[model samples]
Target chain A: MSTPRTPTIGLFGLGAFGRLILRHLGPHFPLTVHDPVHHDSAPPERAAACDIVILAVPVAAMAETCAAIAPHLRPGTLVVDVGSVKIEPARVMQQTLPAHVQIVGTHPLFGPQSARDGITGRNIAVCPVRGRAHLRIAAFLRRVLGLRVILTTPDAHDREAAVVQGLTHLIARVLVEMEPLPGRMTTASYARLMEAIDMVRGDPPGVLAAIETANPHARPVRDRFFATAAAVARRFESGDAGGEDQRRRSRRALIG
Target chain B: MSTPRTPTIGLFGLGAFGRLILRHLGPHFPLTVHDPVHHDSAPPERAAACDIVILAVPVAAMAETCAAIAPHLRPGTLVVDVGSVKIEPARVMQQTLPAHVQIVGTHPLFGPQSARDGITGRNIAVCPVRGRAHLRIAAFLRRVLGLRVILTTPDAHDREAAVVQGLTHLIARVLVEMEPLPGRMTTASYARLMEAIDMVRGDPPGVLAAIETANPHARPVRDRFFATAAAVARRFESGDAGGEDQRRRSRRALIG
Candidate 1:
């Protein structure tokens, strides 16, 4: 049982994203994984005693995960969480983990569906919370994984995620609900919109939950979008020239 | 004039789309151009007397343009329109122009912005309203212009356009109005959404007007999109779990 503990990775939560991390990082490192709900509950301390501990649980389960792994974590161990929203998870890891343990928060700006082809050139926002260990993580993501690493603060990441992931998921869900959209007679622009929908349509429920609910900036962004849409709708309904009157005239002209 | 009339193309309306047409077709044929407002008015009669008369005007201006060109069009001449909507322009051309003049309605799916690189592999809906001249037009579009020709009737084109052009323009307009969207830390899906907006943001007011008002099927599609969006908004604002409760928990967990 003399396995060298050279840069071992202990990954928790066998969710969609957890599996993705495993598939990509498995060949490069000695990997140990545990998911209490999905996989065999390997002793928490054994998985936690690795060189790096990655929590891939939902944002809702972040607090409990941190508390469970806190005592077992070694002093120099680096802890990272891959959640859609950055600020909350960053805070949780920084506060709950031991002061000597390093913490980094990352939001892989893609899902299993979007990264289906590959993760090369995909963006990953890395927010350093407790230590400079993120520098190494960012380098590995860029050099080895062929990812685009965005070094940013947790708050800044959430600010942009409000519009980036929030609006994308929100718009995509609504558009998917309006499914059976036109397949024929599509323009270049329409095709692009469909592509955007296709990228996010199959995202897991927790991904949307973290984006729309867990992120603090998400609501304001969503509200602003809805308000703007309502204003546009009102402009059309109020008999604007390009609305009721012009529509009627256009209809009459077509028939006559 | 001693010039040979080798399939001369008479183009009207020197707007963005008209210029695109002139740039593409100018090299292939003897050209006569007239625009009452933009360029010098070369008299409607001269432009209408060519082998192919193209009306690149607004949907609202379709009837007037048709009436102006009807008196001068020769028998066996082809009259085509490049409007966003198909049914109204097709009907207007069929009704106002001389019966002997062949009427073909074309809606180029790619605009100047989208086809800036080239018009190769673009889509153009060609609906034959009066004569079989559309077959030749379709061939030329496929072979010469390298466009994909969709031979659909006026109503069928409008039905599909209502979803394609209508949704693209409406959503684009709302998104454009909400300017300064997330530029950095954007996911691939968000970038695609931005690309869709970029393609249609520069489109003229008349293009949006035609999509939202002129096309009879446009209104219902727009209404359905708005209704679907409203349902999504309602789900969030009603203190839904993924909305308020989880949001509050997320914030508290971050602090504690």
Candidate 2:
């Protein structure tokens, strides 16, 4: 049993983002970790029975992990997920976890690479699922962890994250695949784009999959992006960009 | 002639970039400026006959600008261009201008927007065409202008820049057209991408046109990018990304 001051936090999964959470949360809470490999520091039931359960596993493994721990969750305990998407994970947790356990869905905006220095000031979207316990979670994330907490619903979080995370990861995936890019002779925008790519290229593959596939809103955003990008490509390729004089005039007007 | 110590510099096309040049070079040299509009302070012939001539015109107007100034250029005078691409401008200058004048092709890697603060550490590509005078220009750019001058041939500059400027502008173009991108709940990478887009979104349309079409090497890079990006979109849309366990293993491998 945890002391009243320090709650027990059961963290499932030890991936890159999981370790980041561990690094921060370990100082404040008593931790019981479970991983598919040999990193299980406690029994699955013991971890699930803690005061707070944190599922850091991929969306693919959420169902299995939730099922394995479902029977052991104590009444009045809090269950949280740090998935990239909100709606899918929120559904899986709400459906699988016991109705007595409180659920909060959070999407941490910074990746392991981006948060290498620290998680301070980084944004986290907190979606309240089954209970008002999200207020407590959001407060802890805000005051104790030095994070920027955005309280939102599952659908609302997914809609914005569809374009935010979806397009970013998609761009990062393609840019990283196009490696050996020019390191010199780069413009400021190119440098910024490359920096953006660097921040997400090292993200786990599951993160990309979850961002692109798990979120329902990602498809329409992707459709719009590809459609718009293809049109731009065709215009440039066909050399049918708007009239040179008008563009020059507009540029001059802005400059003057 | 003002004095032997201060040579007159003829600046043509007083657009945004031309104004940037005037701001920097005006303090150092005796300036004679000309523009297509009412900003022409000197006769076109007088501007062309200055000791050194700088062309800050668009690629579309390069031929006409060069033809207008060709007959007035003095022997042993130096002519330089600050175009986005090198090969086309270099060809225009070499073919149109008299062989008696020295020519240097330079692409100031930073635009007026990027150089808003200053150009102290920015990059400038110098391609020597018909003269040994590029040596002096490179020295002045390195020493006086505080620019990192990359000396290369027209072909080499275009080849490398095709990827550097080509893809950056292309991506910026598409992303900008996808306006009202989510500002809140943005990841670090998304923020970086937005910064990149902001830096180039205001670019004159001619700059984008020159980067995409005027540079011969841009087409192949664009084709490759579009092809790879399409494949990525297809894979994600079809949900045919690699095996989930494989990705998890790789992510765990990286994290652990």
Candidate 3:
């Protein structure tokens, strides 16, 4: 049992983002970390006994991890999963956890790379699954961590993320594959684009896959994005020699 | 005739980019400004009388503008066209200007928006088309303007730009249309990408059209880009329920 002075936090999955969360949250709360591959990590039962249990695994492992920890959690344990897409994790937590346990679905928009300077002022979206604990957690995230809290539903977060993250990863993957030499010759915009690509350059293949597949809305947005690109490319290729002018006019009409 | 201490310079376009050049070069040289629509601007013949002539028109107007001013230029006058793509403009300058008039093809990689703060350490690609004027111009651009100069052939510039500018504008156009609300929720990369798009958002339709069409190398690169995107999207759409695993494996093979 945690006293009012120091509530124990069990941080599951000590990956890059998970470690980041630990760095910020560990200083304020008594923390116990558990990673499957880490020899130093505590056992699942130890984490389940903590006041707050944060599941920081990849979206693919969310369901399995939640199922593994559900039976060990106490009646009032607060279970949180920080997945990029909220809908799946929200559903999984609601279904797997006991009625007495609380669930909060969170997506920290910035990761280790982005939060290197600091996590202050970064945005975090929270979707409360089955708890009033979210109100207290949101306050803690804002007041202690200095993060901007966006309280939204799981569906709303997924719908917006479908365009935000889906298109970002899609374009970045293609641009990186092209191996563009946007060196010193880069225009201001090109330099910004390259900077964006470099940020996600180190992300794992699994993370990229989950961003594309785990969110149901992401597929439809990806389809529309590629189709729009293909349609524009086709117009450029099939046009007459003098078709450049017509194409310009049409583009203005379409985009403007 | 002008003294070595102060060369009379004529700027023949006062558009956004041209004004940026003016803000930098105007104070150094005895300047004459000309724009066809501006009532207070000097006529073409007046610009022709200057010791150095700079045409900062869009790529589409390069040939016609060069032709209009060709007859008025003195035998020893240096005529330079600051165009984005080099091969076409280089050819236009070489064919239009008289043998006695020197021509230098200059593409200032940074523009009004890019150099808004200042152009110190920015890059400028100079392709020598005719005579030794390029040597002097290059030195002036490097020493006085504090620009990093890349001396390359017109073909090389066009070839590299095909990938750099082509892919940038292509990706930006689609993402901008999606109206991504990348404000506070932006990851590090998405923020950079948005910054890049913002830089080019105000560019005229003509500039976008020229970037796609004027550089012949851009077409093939654009084709490969769209084809690659289509292939990836198709794989995602056609794969079974467990497609994410297969897709990630294939993307690893393809990109890695």
Best by TM-score: 2
Q: Candidate 2's residue-wise lDDT over A1-256, tens digit each?
A: 9665778999887778789989999989889987756553666777788999999888777877788788889999899999988888888898998889999999889978899888899999999898898898889999998999999988999899989988888877887778889888877888898999888877766777888988889989988988898899888877755445535653443212
DockQ of 2: 0.47
Which lDDT values do the candidates have, in the order given? Answer: 0.83, 0.84, 0.79
Model 1: colliding residue pairs: none
lDDT of 1 by residue, A1-256 (tens): 8996569888877778899999999989988887765435566677798899999877877988898889889989999999999889988888888998999999899888888999999999999988889999999999999999999999999999989888888888888888899877889899999999998877765577778877889889888887888787666555352445444443433211
State TM-scores per candidate.
0.88, 0.94, 0.91
Candidate 1 lDDT by residue in tens digits, B128-223: 888899998999999998998999998999999999988888788888888878787888899999999999988876677788777889888878
Reference contacts recovered by each candidate, as fractions?
A: 0.44, 0.50, 0.30
For residues A17-89, what per-residue lDDT tens digits would candidate 3 score against the true structure?
Answer: 7899888987798898888667767887898789999988777677677778887889888999888899988
Which has the better DockQ: candidate 1, or candidate 3? 3
In the order shown, what is each candidate's alpha-carbon RMSD? 5.4, 3.4, 5.1
Interface DockQ per candidate: 0.30, 0.47, 0.32
Per-residue lDDT of candidate 2, residues B38-81 (tens digit): 55367788889999999988776787788889999999999999
- Ordered by DockQ, highest first, the candidates read 2, 3, 1
Candidate 3 residue B57 Cα shift, in angstroms, is 1.2
lDDT of 2 at B208: 83
Question: Best DockQ goes to which candidate?
Answer: 2
Lowest lDDT block of 10, candidate 1 chain A? A247-256
